[model samples]
Target: MALGMNRDVFITCAVTGAGDTAGRSAKVPVTPEEIAAASIEAAEAGAAVAHIHVRDPVTKQGSRDLALYRETVRLIRASGVDVILNLTAGMGGDLTLGSVEAPLPPSAVGTDMVGATERLAHVAELLPEICTLDCGTMNFGEGDYVMTNTPAMLKAMAAQIKALGVRPEIEIFDTGHLVLAQWLEKQGLLDGPVLVQLCMGIPWGAPDDIGTLMAMVNNLPKDWIFSAFSIGRNQLPYAALAALAGGNVRVGLEDNLWLGKGVLASNGDLVAAAKTTLTSMGAKVLTAAETREKLQLKKRV
Candidate 1:
């Protein structure tokens, strides 16, 4: 097959995720202050966007506290860092079933389902330049946990996101998620500039293979913008793969914890590594300003 490489690319650093990864790596930022600092570091390291997920400073678990989101956004803007802020609006939809036999009632320990309005409370309050929209529901990972996002829920969130004038980074974990995104576009909920994040290599979702990646890329709307990343060791490698596939790149502790063998990574280290990889491939890493212009983002401070 012929190469359709993108000469110019922008990197998005997913600083931290809504997962139980803080204890696994000391570099994972938990507090709002730390999250903000990590984002600034990524911005300095050539990442045009900082994908943020706040954690409970006390429990070190992911949180959807509006105050935490507020403080984190405030600090990032106050530092005069110019990276486009992209907050995760994918929380509050977690579902952990009781068991294989008694699945009638969800497990109270891990299940966190809420209304669409509450799920996006942080986005409605913070008004970041870009926010995530998990495009479809899927069996997220192990055991009984399922990432639940029904069509009705997605439509409601997309409509509100459009009304708020915030760009939705449509997160496609599998091929079906991409189809759902197309459906959302057809429904006029995703009318404006569309951006997608192809999340690969997660168990029960899309695998991180070249052929699978290209298939997902080929299925995307020609005019839509996209970035791609895989978790773990494949994270940095995806920088080159994404650019080669005519897309952008994403990297950070949220997706991977290591800078090298036996070397834990900070968010900055991941972004720097991705930058070096993309640049080594002769791809020009775009700055924050250029990214904003390309995506037609509305900057709010």
Candidate 2:
């Protein structure tokens, strides 16, 4: 345990997630340029990796458009940031059902479903070093909307992602999702040195409390490399907590937007803050090269 205990931890900055968060903070990057700038800033501040999601520039709405993803990746690469790019393949699976009395006719605007391959269209083309494979479907936020990732859909997507030579960072929102991830491993769909991200404190998912976090951490495969994060005000604290718990840390406007009360945070602010927190806990923060080696990621061109 001590030998593993002293290992340097990697930090990931979820630069701009595809969420309805633009109106909440002007700093939230909406377009490709803004997202790329944010990623560069996060890298300058200490993030070895940047987890990205693209949004429609005009509407500022989350999009799975290949062009948007292409532009975002291009901008980041052009900026010369030494950061690992992690694209989100978790889009195009929202399901919004009608009222229980009339469940047959689902809502139109909020519900977007597509084939698993369609969801990974951007990842297939860009071939980012890593992309997320959300392990299971779950209720999201205050809505009739539920995220819909059936096991069959996941299996098909996993096969395609593997075919593209991209590593899948399994996103587990709860204990059950971990069960599904392990099952995928058993079937050999997920490659070795599996990377998992424990998304804690998301609604209807795992809680941020110690016991719950520990439960999810304890259930992970011994050799699996993992990271963990919590949303909102708990974001910075989780950096120390994750490092102490033997996992990496994720922080950004995607999970939090305030450096302090009444102070809006840029992505760099969050990464710098998390780095400070990890250092205070006596944990060495690994760089992009070191993290890539530790995770067994291939070098990006």
Cα lDDT, model 2, residue 180: 96
> Taking the tens digit of each residue's C-alpha lDDT, what string does model 1 give over 198-296?
999998999999999999999888889889999999998898999999999999999899999999999899999888988888989999999999999
- List where candidate 2 sits over 4 angstroms from the true fold: 1-7
On lDDT, the leading prediction is 1
Question: Each model's TM-score, in the order given?
Answer: 0.98, 0.97
Ten-residue stretch with the least lDDT total in model 1:
1-10
State the C-alpha lDDT per candidate. 0.92, 0.90
10 residues in a row with least lDDT, candidate 2? 1-10
> Tens digits of per-residue lDDT for model 2 on 35-105?
99999999999999999999999999889989989998998888777899999998988899887678658
